[model samples]
Target: MSALDAATAFAEGLFEELRVNTTDAPGITRAAYGAGEEFAHARVRAAGRELDLDEATDAAGNLYLTLAGTTPQLPGWILGSHMDSVPHGGNYDGAAGVLAGLAVVHALRQEGRRPERNLTVMVIRAEESTWFPVSYLGSRAAFGGLPREALEARRADSGLTLREHMERLGLDPEAVARGKAFLDPARIHGFIEVHIEQGPVLERAGVPLGLVTGIAGSFRYRHGRCLGAYGHSGAVPRAYRQDAVLGFAHLVAALETSWDGLEREGLGATITFGEVATDPVQHAFSKVPGEVGFCLDVRSESEGVLERLHAELMAHADGIAQRRGVRFEFGARTGSTPAILDPALRGELAQAAGRAGLRAIEMPSGAGHDTATFAAQGVPASLIFVRNQHGSHNPLEAMRMEDFAAAVRLLLAFLAGRPA
Candidate 1:
């Protein structure tokens, strides 16, 4: 078998293993700094050892496996992505990127070929903000960019502070809080990530891969609430009752107008209320809902669009409060800035794809990725999206092994005979 074949098989086996071990019924769960994530890190680390790669880790538990270059002085490549997944999310979301990196390195080693510069496969931690409300938790921590207050952020399921979680895993949260950096942007040649497309664009385009141009930024309210006074559903008159659900519904409807306005202007933005519900303990079917809990996520590649949407949101909320006799409490805002990818590197990858007779499109990412973290740090970076089925972040998310093989081939072609 060829080197690529062996690596592909390795990835296939690992994927199944991950799915089996991390099974959470409907899908899989790899909570940030949690048990499933721990197992994944350990498994990948074992693979790194088998490959004889140089191993290292940071205060934030980001793992680095390096295939050392012949020339120690040249700037090297860092290929990485996070390992954690959203609750009941599919197996491929973040894991594909890491496995692609490994496949590239494993293929090179199989042929006993050494690159001009070092090649590192990084296993980033906690990129899924679904577990802890902070975005890019592990990547930002690698650059000492994580805010101190983020350490206090509680995990959504476990209700433990990030500090406590880190401590349980025998990792150093103090150094993380102190802003200790493990990666130097200047010394890196470039960063690249291979991930499954979270949307249907590539599958619809009849293509196997896409080279991302930019990644969207987001403003998220994870613990938003609508508060009102409870009343008897049958007895309370419509004029006097304060319905929290109606207030929440009005806000949802009002945001569509802003989205439509942006669409009319040829601007792109998305407004989502991912979670919405009234308190289970304090509510009944016959009672008027006194309160509603929700989480709002607004994203766009343009900062201007984000601001405009935010402004419109506040205005709508104000009007809704007065008319519905309810108040909105949007707890602690967390977000990330949009990233413009390195086009020069993208052009080079495009050239490689062209050379290999593979069809790859250039597109903008609506979803966020750890690659954005690298781009924000002034590192030259690119994101490659492999075609996927049924979208992402859910149980039915799917990617073809053949399509994955195409991505690994693209990376192999790009890395082959490249300059230092």
Candidate 2:
């Protein structure tokens, strides 16, 4: 069988094996630092063992399956992605890239083909920030970029700290707290991630794959709250009432208006108040709400645009608070700066894709990935996107096997042609 065929079969098999971890729906629930994630990692480890690749886990639980080259001392290449998924997310989101890496090496091994430089297939941990509210934990830790405070942050459900989770997994939390770099920056030639494009651009453009131009960065307020005086809903006059809900409503509207204007003016940006609600204990049908809690996420490919958006958001909040006589309390905000893909690697990928007779679209990624973390650490990084449908982060994500095969072919070509 061709390498593309083998990789496709390998990915399908792995997907079926891991799909049983779902709960509440037909999607995966392999949350980061959870049992499901552990199971998936075990499967990857087993696969690496079958290929006779040397395997190890880093201080933060990132798994590396290595195939040494003739000159192992030189900086090597890494092909990898995360293994964790969001709650009720699809099977292919993160797993596809990981399996693609393994399949490439497996195909090479079977064919007695060896690369000139060492190649490491990485299965990173906790790339999905849904559970911990911190993005790319595994990759960041590998690059010594994870903040110390993130180590002690508690998980939303299990209430266990990230450090606790690491200890349970037999990884040294102390090393992570010390901000250890498991993979030396100087010893890494490049990082490449194959991922499903979570947007409709590729599918709409009628292409099987795409080359990522850049990854958008984001600022998030995970636990923001607005406060105002509580008063009787019926008795309080609209002019006199300090309605917190109204204040929050106005804030959302203002931010959205600005977002709309910015987009119309050709600046690409997005804002979402993904979570918002009034306090159940303090809220009543007969009473005006005194508090509003929400989560805010703002993303952009341009740092300048993001800075302006942040300023406008704060200004709108201030105006809403003043006009409504409400107070705003924003929780700890975290963000990563925008990252541009390496142009040279991108050119290589495009050439490889062309040689393999696959048409590819070029676009920017709205969602963040582990590739961004590697780029932030000064590594030349690239991301290849396989066209997918139904918008990602849910069970309905539909990626065709044909597209998967096309991506595998491109990946194999790229790996085979890399400079020694």
TM-score of each: 0.98, 0.97
Worst 10 residues of 1 by lDDT: 411-420
Per-residue CA lDDT of model 2 for 76-110, tens digit only, reads 99999988888888888888899888888877886
Alpha-carbon deviation at 330 in model 2, angstroms = 1.0
Candidate 1 pairs with clashing backbones: none
lDDT of 1 by residue, 1-420 (tens): 999899999999889999999989899999999999999999999989988999999999999999999986888999978889988999999899999988888899899988888999999999998888888999999999999999999998989999999999999999999999999998889999999999999999899999999999999998899999999999999999899999999999999988999999999988889889999999998999999999999999999999899999999999999998999999888888999999999999999998888899999999999899999999999999999999999999999998988899999889883665
Off-target runs (Cα >4 Å) in candidate 1 are none
lDDT values, one for every candidate: 0.93, 0.88
- C-alpha lDDT (0 to 100) for residue 319 of candidate 2: 90
Q: What's the C-alpha lDDT at position 276 in model 1?
A: 94
lDDT of 1: 0.93
